[model samples]
Target: MASPLIGITTMNALRHDGLAAVSLLRRYVIALTEAGATPVLIPSAMPDDGVDALLTRLDGVLFSGGGDIAPEYFGGAPHPRIGGVDPERDALELALLRRVVEDGVPFLGICRGCQLVNVGFGGTLYTHIADQHPGALKHDYYPDSPRDLLVHEVRLKEGSRLAEIVGVEVFRVNSLHHQGIERLGDGLEAVAYAPDGLVEAVEVPGHPFGMAVQWHPEWLTAHATARALFRAFVEAARGSD
Candidate 1:
């Protein structure tokens, strides 16, 4: 059987030398490759026509972590703490995500990807979790600690698809985002939550395979739970073949 082709979204960046580039962390590629899939980087600035063409050839789509989504996309006013916003990436991913949902393509979203999936489905977000969610633990731990450091435990909902895949009701995950889901999108279910009750994972009901987690699983691929998540995603992509 051919290896499943998984398209992972890239971030938009400008090099110090003054050139535009599409960027994604190497761990994402490594994780997908180790999971038995061919990883393809999808640039954030693809034209609408190109997006449709690209999705047609992809077996699965992985929305990798990146900067914050624009507030306008989710019907919110700009918050002072909102980080760099990429409208192009937001538009591209939203369009691609719609196709993925409509076509039932295997999909996994991480971090910002998770937030995008929520807004794409008409959900709202807490622009800054700590600011809006009182007494919540600090989530943006990327700058001060290692990427693989475990920051919090998320309890998986009983009978959730996520629980079945990870085979654990409670697990540790690294938190590195300031924004979080405030209102889940239509047809989506929150399958996991932190001790503070913030949604940690979500799944679309009735979809063959659609899941998003707030943590960066690519950085924790060594963990059995992380590997299982990717393996299940790859297997679902293989089913599309």
Candidate 2:
């Protein structure tokens, strides 16, 4: 039997990249499928205003990471090096996230997804972490390396959802994003933080499972705890359906 279908938000590529090219992230898919759910990648700029149709077909939504969110949404000037900030993709994904939030569906956001979730709900972002968090732990540890992993430590909040997901109060994770969370939205709980004291994870108030992690747990291997995070997310999503 097929598993519940969860919507994965994608970044826009081009006419040749296909629709799933936007929302279907590779590690996210592997993580979701490993957790027993059917992963569906919805495009960044879906036609026919087909968002409702996409939501109807989805059991959950995962805002996969890629690109910077256009700063204009949160009343900020764009940074010169803010690469891949697509307005069209941001608009569609924000709309989808809002809808999913209203309905209390299980939602998982990683890196950019975390920023998108916060921004979608009236939060702001630091265009560049180095510029914003001066004297911070230099989160952009790997600037131009072609490798997939950038390792760093994160602090999990006590009695929060993230501590339970990763199965430890604190752990190390891979970091690749230059942008970080600035102002968290109302009703969202901050669950984890980097060594620099940046908010790393968030959970919704009284929700079964609604959380966003600042680091890319997907890129972490030898960590069943990261997989358990998705397992719990998919389980909550399944229960929602």
Candidate 3:
């Protein structure tokens, strides 16, 4: 039998469980399932005392994209643009990230997932773009536009795994994140970066396999290289060590 896959969910804050719920993305579930792993949803609301209970049953963990992480997490005050911050989800996923890292479990983090992993590991976010990175292409979601396929060219570090995965030095990726990695975490190295110098991807050195990306590859599931990412992650979750 194939090994099962895990996708982290936002804590169930409100009663509704629709698209608005603070949980795993439906697209991520589709991608994981299509990538040959059974999707198991882990709630971010899991109690601090029960963090282990959720960790033991999974082969891998995926932190899905969502709203802003409370700046209080990284010891800063909230900015006016800092809307939709979730404290419960922040508390839960931070513990989960630390636990998974200690356990040497394979993990993947998406946009907000990327930011959360950064902050969870003692890194900081740009928070507001104007306040940090001045004058850059706006990276906001455009739900109603006809040309929704927004693209930006990101340059990969020569020897980075990103280069290996995509088999290209420069690639076009859609950007929807406002906050970006300001400083990389202690054990983390950025594998890809945007033209504007925002860290687009990060990985931990000497780990089973854990990586985070600021772009939503899951949304582009049919793309060749995007599929490679899911395959690499599923394969990593089954590490021989």
Candidate 3 lDDT tens digits, 58-165:
888888887888887776556787876877778888888998899988889989899988998899888875577766656665444322254787788898776787
| TM-score, one value per model | 0.98, 0.90, 0.90
Instruction: Let me know the TM-score candidate 3 reaches against the reference structure.
Output: 0.90
Per residue, candidate 1 scores C-alpha lDDT tens digits across 119-158 of 9999999998988886898899978999999999999999
lDDT of each: 0.92, 0.79, 0.77
List the candidate 1 regions with Cα displacement exceeding 4 Å. none
Candidate 2 regions with alpha-carbon error over 4 angstroms:
14-25, 141-150
Cα lDDT over the full model 3: 0.77
| Superposition error at 139 for model 3 (Å) | 1.3
Best by TM-score: 1
- lDDT tens digits, residues 54-153, model 2? 7777788888888998888987557886998788888888888888888777889988999888888788888988888756676665556522454667
Q: What is the lDDT, from 0 to 100, of the residue 126 in candidate 1?
A: 95
Backbone clashes in model 1: 0
User: How well does candidate 2 score on lDDT at residue 110?
Assistant: 87
In angstroms, give how far residue 207 of model 1 lies from its true place. Answer: 0.6
